[model samples]
Target chain A: MIGRFVARRAAMLVATALVASVAVYGALFIAPGDPATLLIGGGKPPSPQLLAEIHRQYHLDDPFLQGYLRWLGGMLHGDAGQSLTYKDSVTHLVTERIGNTAFLVAYAAVLIIVPGVTLGTVAALRGGFGDTLVTVVTTALMAVPTFVMSVVLIWWLSVQWDWLPAYGAGEGFTGRLEHLTLPALALATAWLAYVAQVTRSAVRAELASEHVETAWARGVPERFVVRKHVLRNAAGPLFSVSGVAVAGLIAGCSIVEQAFGINGIGALLVQSAAKQDLAVVQALALITVVVFVVVNTLVDVVTAALDHRVSLEGTA
Target chain B: MTGSPPLLVVDDLRVDLPTRDGMRRVIHRADLTVPAGTAVALVGESGSGKSMTARAVLRLLPSRARTTGSVRFDGSEVTTLGAAGLRRLRAHDVAMVFQDPRAHINPVRTVGDFLTEALITTRGVRPRAAEAKVTALLREVGIADASRRMRQRPPELSGGLLQRVMITAALAGEPRLLIADEPTTALDVTTQAEVMAIIDEARAERGLAMLFITHDLALAAAVCDRIAVMYAGGVVEELPARHLHERAAHPYTRALLASRPDPAATAEPLRAVPGRPLSAFETGPGCAFAPRCAHAQDLCHTERPSLSPAGEGLAACHFPAADARVTPQPGARSTPHGR
Candidate 1:
C-alpha cells in the first residue's frame, strides 16, 4: 500500500514538473522583442549574417511547436541556453544562487516551526487569556506584509540595536547564519502566523475528538495523551501547512533577499526579469514550480505515511 | 450478586452542568450497585443521565460541570482519589468500553497500538509481551485472525470488529470492573447480538463486574443480572432482571415493559410511551416523570418521592403498580426542593 502511495505521488510530481517546465519555456517564446535577441543576449546590434547563423544554430526558423520541443529536449540534456543580461550559463547562475535560497528557507523554517507550534499548543491547552493572547499576536503578525516586516526588523535590529549586519550575504556558516537572522524572521512572520493558526485549530479540534477523550479515560497519562494522541493526530495538518509556508517562501525570499542585499536566486530572478533576461527568468520560474510540486508531494506522502486511514483508505 | 459483595456502590449522586442558560442539575440523583462478578444494567431513555452516571465513575465529566456524589469501588471512594490514585483505578482496577467504537479509537493508530497502550504504559508490560497478551484477549473476544487485524487501522474494520478491539483493550488491563456504555449501539442487529454475546461471555469468563448502559429493556434484562431503570436523571426503579417482566413496581418501569412490542400478538397496536422524554435540566419540582404518569395525583405533583423498598427491589413512586401504595414506605421522605 505504501509502495503504491509513493509511486502515485512520484508520478504526480514528475507530471507536474514537466507541465511547469513546458509553461516556463513557452513563456520565453511569448515574451516581447526579437527571438534572435533572446538567443544572442542582444548586448550589441547583430549583423544579418550573425542573426541568420544564430537562427539556424538555434532552429528559430522552425515552427513554434518544433522550436518548443527542441528547447525542451535541450533542457532535458542540460543545455538551458544563456541569459540575455549576463550572457552567462543559466544552470551555473541558478545553481550558484539556489543554495542561498535553500539556506534562507531552512533558517526561516526553524523560526516558523518553533514558535508557531508552541504558541498554537499553548493557546489550545491553556484557554481563556492564553487563547486571546495568541489570537491577538498571530493576527498582528499576519497583518504585517513581509517587506514591511523586513524594513522594520532591519531598522530596529540592525540600525537601533546595531547587533546584526543590515545587508549582504556574509562569509562562512556562523557569519551567514548571523546575517540571515533578521531577513529570515522577516520572511517567517506571515507564514509563522499561518502555521500557528493552523496548529491552534488542529489542536482544538483534536482535543474535542472522541478518540482523545477515550485516551484520557483510558488513563493514558496527560503527557502521552497530548503527545501520542493529540499532537500526532494534529500532525497531518501541521505537515501540509508547514510545507506550504516553506515552499511559498519564494515570494518572501525574493523581497527579503533584495532588502538584505543577499545574492540569492529569488532576487536574481527579479533582476533578470527587469533586464528582460528570458533564460534566467524561465529557469527560475521552472525552479519555483518544481519546488512547490516537490514540497507539496513530500508533505502529502509524509501525511499519508503517518496516518493509516489516509494511506490505506486514501485521503478523506 | 449471590455470595459476592458489592464491588461498586454509587449513592445519592448529583451533577450540575453549566449550559448557555444556567447551571442545571443533569444527574439529580443516581444510586446503584454492582456486586463483584455480577453485571448491572443502567437502562434509560435518551437524556436520562445513564451515561453521565457511568462517566462519573472515572471523573470524566465536562470541565465546568459541578458534581457532588459518593462513588465507591471495592470500598475506596473514586471521586476523592488523587491523580495517581485515579490513574491507578482507571488503568488497573476499572476499564470502559464506549458507545461508538469507531469514534473512540484513534483513527490513525493501529488496533494493536490501542490494545497494547495501557498494558505498556500503565502496567510496564513490555511491547512484545503486551502484543502476545492482546492477541490472546482478541481471540477471547471472538476475533480469530488477531494479527492481521492488529496491523490494520480502525476504519479498515467493521463496527463489530472495532468493538471487539475495544473489548480486547478493556480486558488488556485485566480490570476488575468493566463499564460497557452502550457498547453495541452503533452496530447492525446481527453484529449487536454478536458483540453483546462476546461481552457477556468474556465478562463471565473473567468474573468481571460490569455496568451496562443501554436503552433496550430486553437486552438489559438478558445481559445484566439486575436492571436499574432511569427516568429523567434519576434511577426510578431497581429490580432483579427475571422479575422485570412480571413484578415491576414503578409506573415508569411497567410502562417501559409494556412499550416493548409483543411479537406473538401481531394484531395488537404498539403501546408508545406518552410525551417526549425530559432532559436532566428540564425536570420539575415533582417527580420528573409525574407529568406523564397516569397514576399521578395532587400530592404527587406537590413533592417528589425518594426511592423506597417495594416488592423484590426498590421503586420511587407515590403510587406503585404493586398493591403497596397510598401509604408511602415509612422511612421514605421528600425534601422541599424535589431535585
Candidate 2:
C-alpha cells in the first residue's frame, strides 16, 4: 500500500510538472509584447543594434528550442532566471515572500481549522439550537467576501480598537503573528464557514446512519458513538475538502495580502504582473501550481489513510 | 423462591408516536412475560408492532416515541429508568439483536473491532480479556477459522456470517434477554437454519431468554417455545408452538396457517388474505382486522376484542376455533405450564 501511494504520487507530480511547463511556455510566447520591446521599453521601434543587444542579453537570439531548453535547464537548478523589472532572480524574490505567506497560512489554519470543524461536529450532534445558530452564523459569514472581511477587520480591530499590527511582518515571531492576524482572519472567515457547513452535514449524515443506530443497539455510550464512530467516519470527506481549502488559500491570497499591504507571495505575484515581468510571473505561477499539487497530494494521502475504500490505482 | 424470576415482564404497554397532526398509538396495550432461559417468538406481518414491542422492552425507542406502561425486567420498572440507568440495563441485562445484520455491524469496522468495542464498553472487559472473550464468542458462533474472519469487515463476510457476528456481539455483554428482530430474514434457507441453530446453541449455553420477532410462523413454530401472532398492531393469538400449528384460533392466525403452501393439497389453490393491513393512522372503533377477517361478524366489525382464553391459550376473536379445544399432544402442556 505504501509503495502504491508513493508510486502514484510520483506519477501525479510528473504529470503536474509537464502541464505547468506547457502553461508557462505558452503564456510567455503567446502574449502581445515581444521580449525585446519589454526589455528596452522604447516608444518607437527599437534600433537594430538595441534589439540585437536585448536578444543577446536574454539568449532570445538563439533558436526557439535552444532558448526553451536553456530556460528548462535553469528551472531544474532551482534558478528561475532573472526578473526583468526587479533586476533579481525570480527564485530569490518568490522564496523571500513565500515564507511570510506560509507563516500567515499556518496561523490561520490553527485558528480556524480545529475550532471550525469541532463546532460543526458539535452542531450536528446537538441539533436544534446549536445547529441552527451555527448554520445562520456561517451562512452570514459566507455571504461576505474575503476582501470585505479584511476591510471590516482592519476598520474595527486595527484602526478602531488598535489591537494588532495592520501590515508587514515585524522583527520577531510574535510580531509577525500580530501583523498576520487580521489578514489571516480575512482569509479564514470564508474557509471556516465552508468547513463548518461541510463538517456539520457530514457528521449529521453519519450520526443518522444505520451503523450509528446499531452502535446504540450495542449499548455503546453516546460519547464514544460520536467520537470513534461519527467523527472518524465523517472525517474522510472533511480532509479532502480541507485539502482543497488549503490549495485555494495559496491560489487566492493575492487580494487578501494586497488589502493588508503584506509582502507575501500573493502581493509579490500581483506586483510582478503589473510590471509585466514574465519570468517572475511564470515563476510565481509555477510556485502556486506546485503548492496546489502538493497540497492536494497530501489530501489524497490523508484520505487514503482514513478510508480504505479509496484505491490508489483508480485515483492515479 | 430460589428459582430465577421471569427475565422480561411487560404489562399494559402502550407506545404513542407524535406526528405532524397528532399522537398515534404504535404499540397498544401489550402484555408479556419471558421466563429465564425460555425462547418466545412474536410472529407478525410488517407493522404488527413486533419490532416496537422489542424496542419498548429495551427502552431503545426514539425520544419522540412516548411509551407509557410497565416494562419490568427482573424486578425494576424499565420505563421509569433514566438514560444512564437504561444504558446500564442494556449493557448488563437486556441486549438486543436487530434485523438486517449487515446494517447492524458497521461496514467500515472489522468484526474484531465491533466485538472488542461491545466487550470493553458494556462488560468493562480489559483488552486482553476482551480479546479472549471475542475469540471464544467467534468460535461459539461456529465460524470456522474464527480468528481470520475476525480481522475482516462485515462487507467481506456473507450474510450468515454477519448475523453470527451480530449474535456474538450481543453475547459479549452477557445479556439475559436477547431481542432478535428477523435475525434470519436476510439469509438463505440453509444459512438461516444454521444461524438459528447457532443462536439456539448460544442461548442454551448462556441460559438466555430470547424474544424472536418474525413473520414466518413455521420458522417460529420450529424455534420458539411459545408463539404470539400479531395482526395490525395487536397480538390476536398466543399459544404454545404445537398449539399455534394445530389450534390457531383467530381468523387472521387461521388465514396465515392456511396461506402456508400445502404439499398435501397438490391440486388446491394457495390461500392468502385479500387485502393489506389497515393503516396505523386510520382511526377505528371496531376491530382493526375486520376488513380481512373471514369470520368477522357484526360484533367483530363493531367492537375490538382484547386477548382472552380461547382454550388453553389466548385468542382475541369472539369465537375461537370449535375443534381447537383438543390439544395436539397430551403431554405438551408440561413444557410451558405457567401461573
DockQ of each: 0.71, 0.52
Query: Model 1's lDDT to the true fold?
Result: 0.86
Error of 2 at A135 (Å): 1.0
**DockQ score, prediction 2:** 0.52
For candidate 2, the per-residue lDDT at A292 reads: 85
- DockQ, candidate 1, comes to 0.71
> Relative to the true structure, how large is the alpha-carbon lDDT of every model?
0.86, 0.81
| Clashing residue pairs in candidate 1 (N, C-alpha, C atoms within 3 angstroms) | none
For candidate 1, what is the total of clashing residue pairs?
0
TM-score against native, each model = 0.92, 0.92
Whole-model lDDT, candidate 2? 0.81
Q: Looking at model 1 chain B, which ten-residue stretch has the lowest summed lDDT?
A: B330-339
Off by over 4 Å in 2: A42-45, A59-69, A312-316, B1-5, B18-24, B263-269, B324-339
Docking class of 2: medium
